[model samples]
Target: MSGRGARGDADESGATSGSLDTVLSFVTGEMAFDPGPYNDAYLDRRVTARIRRTEAETYREYRGLLEADEAEQTALLDALNINVTRFFRNPDVWTVLRDVLAELTANNRTVRCWSAPCADGREPYSLAMLARDDPAIDANRLDIVGTDIDGEALAAARRGEYETTRTTDIAEELAPLSDLDAHVDRDGDSFAVRRPVREMVEFRRHDLLREDPLGEFELVLCRNLLIYIDGDHTRDIFDGLAAAVVPDGYLTIGKSETLPREFRTSFDAVERGAHVYHHC
Candidate 1:
């Protein structure tokens, strides 16, 4: 009877020690910001994964490690923010952007674009390539800014070097439209974005949730970012992005993402299939 009681008490204690709220509180209090904007299940899954990696039996133990080790904090944050991206990803989206660019540069000398949460610079660099290939627009006239919350990712973006597999992927995707070899310089097993394309884009560290959009942009690409956020926060983020675009400018989100119902009146869908919306 005594042994059973002791085991029961230990189980209860373990459960208490691994409370999700405790881990969240520690992260929020220590990080000085609420990560609640992210989906709860997504956060839980990542936290669980991190706990497993750390071999911590309880959330409390993991929280202690997060508090004591800066590396662990970075690891946890990186795990939470999924940065999976590829150049010319979702080819149809780029086709819409190319058409938009043609119209945007018709009357203006320079067309400005902002790629928010631009992981590893692929999206913005892809934009630069499109502008370079377009006869209507001079690549030099494109002022593109790629911003991400991860400084390390931004650093990688600045390097502009990608493995052969990724470069090959870009080449295959763009083969129908343009010669990929023209835009990249190949090194043994890696490829570097050519100077022309790399020069047109500037990569910086920016947080979409914490900071306002940089400035008025002719096009804003916020793809593959909203699915991680909860509904309310997603709406709030859309509001910020809509406000950032010029009156007639274009906003392209992830193919799977949709604007909140409240924003239906503000933005007219330019291409329903491509998820391109024009700010009114």
Candidate 2:
């Protein structure tokens, strides 16, 4: 519920969505967006213009188009989405994950992880590797589920096959930053997750803007995706995520974003520089 929806007087709401405005509107209403680079006018204009090329001329008209055509809507969503991801993209976060797993496994049951907005399929797969390679971590005991709103990304995630050469990039990932590094066998030709590693993850299309958590998790990663969503939606998402994690579970986000002050009380910072948090 970003500032996108109509206010009390303007809206009599149950639930409604599917327009460029719907996304833009939600973000603005829900979050205090960066007016300069990520402004309301900018978001509306960009979405409108992008859809217009396909004959969706106006914001309202685009809404009609989205509502009238499901496939078209999906395409529109794909078009608007920003999925800039890489294997083990954030060195710092990966560092925290490795340490946290080894430390927590010492006392926990099975470790459950949820990767939200798992775009194009790298993050979760990389995580699967972490569990499989770490001796202290019983890969069989780890279950990582990746969720994204886009069906395309979910499909890719399910396939679990990437060009072999892509793996090389991860081998030296964060090399200069050893304290921030997580061992990765960056060999792209061998990039495909082994069947066993793939078995550890479940990928699904979940609209974090809308859905509730299906089960509890020990660790949850909602990264770059939320920066696009407005505060209210982010808030709603975090609330749902919080409830979905065990009382002592961990909640992790991108190194760039931090939980709101209100939520800081709910999860404690487990690793300072790597930006990991655990339920208090």
Candidate 3:
């Protein structure tokens, strides 16, 4: 749902130029949400879905509804920011991460990590669990931050809980590094991250496209979000990511994503298939 391009660019999704402008303007001016960095087709699809759900005949009417209803505005923002994630999402990549974490914590210093666009806290909590269970790592020195533009998702993350289905992968691939007692507590059909793991992590609301990198980190996981960005803005986002990682620090992107051509030299691929990089 993130891309950057001319607002007047032709869109065959059926939203008229004037009406689309009206909607985008209100979102930017009033809500402080910038839609300019989102792909047009993706934005159109999300906006159109909202329009249909609200039964608004035109984008202008949708804007009117947005002005009148705060809840609808939240819904629209949620719709625009699509976040798909799961715990220990890619086991192989996480296998590589095991070595990375051990190496990062070898200095016995605080290790800072960021999970950008972290949906519902699964990824960062997964990292915490890994750090906590691994005897070689000092879990007390771990500082993890999970950020996303979706207000609702951030709230869910702050709760530090997830449905049973969301945690199935832990049993499948991360059982060795997982300490259910110290990391999670199961209740009925759901699970909540235990105090030890939850203490190491914090969640914040951040917009990658509109805001600066939160700070430099030893590890940054900006997985799976670059696919939706347009080419020009993709480079910009990648640059921001590069800036966020300390020299020789690690940056892990989605397996499906590649480093933009210009960044190939600046970041050496530590594990090409896992999409782990060492910033130079």
Best candidate (score: lDDT): 3
Candidate 2, lDDT over the whole model? 0.66
State the C-alpha lDDT per candidate: 0.80, 0.66, 0.81
- Which lDDT value does model 2 have at 181? 24
User: Across residues 106-184, which tens digit of lDDT does each residue of candidate 3 receive?
Assistant: 8868889999979888899989998878887767767999999888889998898776565354444346555566677
Root mean square deviation (Cα) for candidate 2: 8.3
Question: What's the residue-level lDDT of 9 in candidate 2?
Answer: 19
- Model 2 earns a TM-score of 0.69
Residue 136 in model 2: shift from native, Å? 3.0
State every prediction's TM-score relative to the real structure.
0.84, 0.69, 0.79
Model 2, residue 156: distance off in Å is 0.4
User: Per-residue lDDT of 139-205 in model 2, one digit per residue for the tens?
Assistant: 6667788998777778887876555344345345424333322333335344445676677788888
Residues forming the 10-long window of minimal summed lDDT in candidate 1: 1-10
